[model samples]
Each structure stands twice: as structure tokens, then as C-alpha cells.
Target: MSSNAAKLIPVFAALALGTSAQTAVAADWYTGAEREIPRDDWIVAIDAAATVTSNSSAFGAVTATIAPVNTLLDSGPRVRLQGVAGTYTYPGTVTGQTVRGVQQEGSVLFGYEWIWQQAAVAGYVGFNVRNNELSILDPGNPVVGTGIGGKVAADIYLNPTPDQFYAVNASYSTQFNAYYVRARAGFAVFNGVFIGPEATLLGDDFFNSWRVGGHLTGFALGPMKFSVGAGYAYDRVRKGGYYTSIESRMAF
Candidate 1:
């Protein structure tokens, strides 16, 4: 081949390579992490807990919640069923069948969650079923009252290992507002169980209560997560009482 022809061929090949490189770079560009929103199709979480709380007045109730799926959200229209029933020995050693429960329906909440990429900070506007039910300890003669509740929280990265999540939340009901803050970190405690303790601050019309406790959760079952928690709620009026909760959750 002629020298001129050979030189022209090399130039065309270089141009083709440059064009291919540009296309590849554009296709491969990515932000690294994807913000995944929960699916809207469906969700249901059931929690069963017992609270032994009572003042000079009466005993507390067993707390249970059957929260049906609304839209996919930290915010959305929802119907939550709350029930609490239990017995306690009064100062007089009195005990019997004590039960009280309530149901609540609320409008959709706004600002489900806030995610910051620059600082790796995450925040969420949390909405729970308003406390439409308040029961006075009287299994023989239970009284129900309607109330409301609220919550908001944020979490920030503290450790470089990305294994710890520190979170804070505020929750209140018409009865009274409860404030809670906690620093949570998890390690392989046993059998890969992630356990973290959180301090709870509770305030209300009946009395003031506080608790410090945690939950043990792990992916033990196939394609499912199992969690159970226990805590001690110290009431100024009700004295000292114990609380326990168990939950089974599945995600698709």
C-alpha cells in the first residue's frame, strides 16, 4: 500500500476508537447507590406486647397493633388497630380479667423520608396510628378514651464501618407528648443477632414514664426477619412495671 493511504487508515482507526470510548463512558456513568422506595403493592406488620402498668388507680393493659398496609410510605392513608389488655395485682392483691383496645384511622402523612447524599444523613417524618384508645385498668369495668400520637426522627452516620445507625425520635399523643433519643450500634452478639438498646422517654396526663431497653433481630427464617424486644417502663405514678413485645416480619 502507498504511504499516504496507510497514514489515512491509521487516522480513521483512531477516530473510531475515540468515539467508542466516549459512548462507553456515558453508558457506564452511575451515582453508586440507588435510593430504593418501598413497594406500594402491600405491607402488614403485627406486634403483640404486654405492659404491666398501673398507678394507685388501676392496672395497665396488653398492647397490640395490627397495622394494615396503606400506600408505600413513611406517609399515607392508614387504618391501625390498637389493643391492650392484661391483669395486674393491685396493692391489695386484686387481679382479674382486664382488657381494653382501640382502633384509629388517619390521613396520609407528608415527608415520608429525607435522604442526604452529600453527608450520608437520613431523616424521616414518622406517623403512627394516633392513640385513639386509652383504657383505665378495669377488666371488670374497662373504660376507653380516644387520643392521638405523633413521631419524627433522624439518623446520622457516626462510624466509618457503616455498621452503626444512630437515631432519635419524638412521639406524642393527645394524652401527652413523649420524647425519646437513643444511640444504637449493633454487632454480632450471638448467632448473628443484631441487638441494640434505646432509651425511651414517655410523658402523658396520667403520669410520667421512662424506659431503657433494646431488641434482638436477625434474618433467621428463610426470606424473613424475626424480632423480639423487652424493656422496663418506670412510671412515677404506677411505680415499676415490665414490658415485652414480639414481632415477625417478611419483606418482598
Candidate 2:
């Protein structure tokens, strides 16, 4: 096996071990508590993560989102608003130069969730507004545009044994010159704790990327929950790249 492929084995194993060992109280919000699923009339959440390529170039972003009503349950639909900011650093097409790019975006989404005997599904569609700064070499130029995006996610808590569950989540977005899709899956190893694989396909006309990796998710402390993942990436036509990401959510 190539050295890079071999490196991922240990990382995946370690993540699995960490996930399996995370035993929380069944009453915890994520472990089939009396609530079954975590929900709130209003929720405030933040997601932050970074991805790095084999060339040492990197991309990082932070997003803050809010839900104004109870929408994650079998009840009714909900509306959400979000803001994001991120930076990208990469080797310039020209030799001996590094290019840095910045982006800021805002979006509003509306979606609904449905709950069955032991499962729930949710989906949402939204409009996005964004500002993309050109390059570190040129500080005053930015391209601004509008776009559309949507997301779909589902969770199934095992019956007879609420400690185990499976989940799938996916999202897609498109603009005048760019579009991307991301998807992930998870299976519970312990009450409220899960491990799974994830993939991403994102980029623009000038650049694109594909990545796959395993993840650990649903580590909750009170009303807060966390997730983390890492994997190798194939950037445009190049290989040997890798990426990692983490996120946290809070419901109130």
C-alpha cells in the first residue's frame, strides 16, 4: 500500500476505538432520552472545520446558524438563517507564489422533519448570497453573487435497543459558476456515540475536489453535541491530499 493510504488505517482505527469507548448515560440527549431526539423551540449552532491538501494548501471556514422554531421533530416545518466566513490558501499557478482567497456567505433555509416509529427525516431548501474575494495578490477585487442550496438528513434509532442507530446527511449548493455536494453516513457504536464515513465533492470551474473519510459523531455534553472527521482528498486532477473537519451544535 502507498504510504498515504497506510496512514489513514491508523486514523480510522483510532477514531473507531474512540467512538466505541465513548459510553454515555442513556438519558443523555442523543441516546434515546425521553425526548427521543434533541429539539428546541429555538436553537443556536456553530460549525467550524478545516481541510488541508497534500501540497500543504488549506481551506478553513466557520458558520453560525439559528432556527427560530421547533422544526427538527415530527411536528412542523422550521426556518433557519446562517452566516459563514472562510479562507483558502494554495500554491499559485505561477511558481514561487502563494495565493490566498476569502469568502463570506449568508443563507436562509426552510425545511420540515418527519418522525416514524424509530426514525426521522428532514429536508430543507434555501437561497444563498455570497462574496468571494479574488486573491491575496489582489486585495481590492471581489466577486459577489447569489445562489441556491438545499439539504436532506435522516436518523433511525434502533428499536428494542435504542443505543444503536444509523444516520445519513447530505447537502448541495450551486451558483452561477460553482456547485458542490457533500454526503455522510454514521452507525452507532455506543449509546449516543456513532462512527461513519463521509464524502465531499466541491469546487468551481477553475478548481474542484473529492474527499472520503471516516468520522466520529454524536458526543454530547448537556445540550451541546460535537462531530469530527478526516480523510484523503483528490484535488482537481491531483492526488495525495487530505482533509479534516469538526463541528458543534447547541439547542435551547
Candidate 3:
């Protein structure tokens, strides 16, 4: 790997170690608690987000996960069915022209989750199929074609206190050598509402990007949660731009 890529290893390692420590502490605390364990046999979660950047690029993504054995609130081995799709627009080879690309991925992963009163973590590994489409030839585009490959993913949620919350999500796919990681932390300002900072890093064989911003998260209405974020984004191709995103998640 290039020196630039090697520099990221430490960041990833620190995050992983922090997650493991938090999980261990939460588990130990729950083991001695008298509260009854919560249980739900099935869960379906959906998340969608859209981002527009100043670099004349707009992107959108949506994902759904179905856990048949246990819900996200509880711990157990589960069969996870996931689907992800993303679309984006970028500058084309010809000046003043634009190109669009779409990516779709499907995975059937075997996963195990551990839940505690204040924290939860889950890990998954599976086979995935990815498809990519480009409206026109754009050598600047990172994702090129379709392939079948292996994928690994992890999710972590932490609520160390009644008024604080943190979440982390990371995933990597062998297809096109793609990877994404995001982390956010918030403090409750009102009932069921949190406001905080967020960061993201994502890349592929030919593209890399990072974002730093703030978010309003955990806005709950009925069974759905909503979040909105705005930040400064920098990418190898686009240099720098501002971005805004809105996300929604539902579990039932």
C-alpha cells in the first residue's frame, strides 16, 4: 500500500480497540444488573440518505437489513439479508457534460449481535454481488464494473449515559476494493433528540473522500428516526466542497 494508505491503519486500529473495550465494559455491567433482558424475534431496518456537494456532484444511497432471528435491541445469532444501492452524478470527459453512475449490492451475511442496556455491537461476514452502471465513459469514475466478492461489516452503538449517544459503522467489500467508515457522537438536547458532530471516510481503488461536519440526530416520530448533517467534504478528484445529507431509519 502507498504511504498515504498506510497512515489510515492507525486510525482504523484505534477505532477497533475502542469498540472492543466499550463492548467488554458494557457486557460486564449488564451481567450484574437485575433488569430483565429485552427480546424481539425479528427486525427490519431501513436507512436512506442523500448528499449534494458543491463540486457539481450529487449522491444518494439506501440500505435495508432484515434480521430474522433477533431484533437489533437484543443479542443473538441471526441471518442477515441486506440490500444496498447508490447513485451519483459526476463531471464527464467532455467539458460541460455530466455522467451518472449507479451501484447495487446484495448480501446474505451470517451475523452475531451482543446487546447491553447501554451499548450494542454486531459483526457480519458474507458473500456479496455488486453491479455498477455508468451512463457514459468517465475515466475519473472510481467504480467501474460488477463483481462477486466477500464483504465484512460492523456496527457499534453506545449510550454511556441517558443524555449521550455515539455510533460507528464500517464496511469493506472486495469488489472494486471499496470501503466506508462513519462515526458520530451526540448529546441529547431535548427528549429523544440529539445534536452532535460526525465524520466519514470512504474510498475505492481510484477515489477517496472525507467529511467533517455536525448533525442533528435521533429525531423520533412514531417508529422512525431522522438525522440531518452538513459539512465540508474533500476528495481526491473534486478537491473540496460543501455537502448536506438527510438520513432516515426505521425498525419494525
Best by TM-score: 3
Candidate 2: residue 13 Cα off by (Å) = 24
* Segments in model 2 whose C-alpha atoms lie over 4 Å from true places: 1-71, 92-97, 136-166
* Per-residue accuracy of model 2 over 1-252 as CA lDDT, tens digit each: 233222212111211221111122336556655423212223343444555566445555554434355423224465546566666655656453566667776667776545454444556687777666645453222233344534332222322223333444444556534555666556777765777777777766466778889788768665556778888888754456777777665433
| lDDT of candidates 1 onward, in order | 0.37, 0.51, 0.66
- In the range 89-148, model 1's lDDT, one tens digit per residue, is 322113533333343433222232222221123233435443434344543322234444
Q: Arrange candidates by lDDT, highest first: which order? A: 3, 2, 1
The RMSD of every model to the true structure, in order and in angstroms, is 16.7, 10.1, 10.2
The backbone clash count of each candidate, in order, is: 4, 0, 0
Model 3 TM-score relative to the real fold: 0.75
> RMSD in angstroms, candidate 3?
10.2
After superposing candidate 1, which stretches have Cα over 4 Å from the reference?
1-108, 116-144, 147-162, 173-183, 190-192
Q: Assess the local accuracy of residue 22 in candidate 2 as a C-alpha lDDT between 0 and 100.
A: 19
Candidate 3, superposed: residue stretches over 4 Å from native: 1-42, 91-99, 138-142
| TM-score rank order | 3, 2, 1
**What lDDT does candidate 3 reach at residue 196?**
85
lDDT of 3 by residue, 1-252 (tens): 333222212111212211110011123375675443212322655666777777656666666555566444456665556666766666665563677778787877777767666666778898888888888877766577889989998888766665676789888989888899999887778855678888999888866899999988766564456778999999876689988988776544
Candidates in order, TM-scores: namely 0.47, 0.64, 0.75
Lowest summed lDDT window (length 10), candidate 3: 16-25
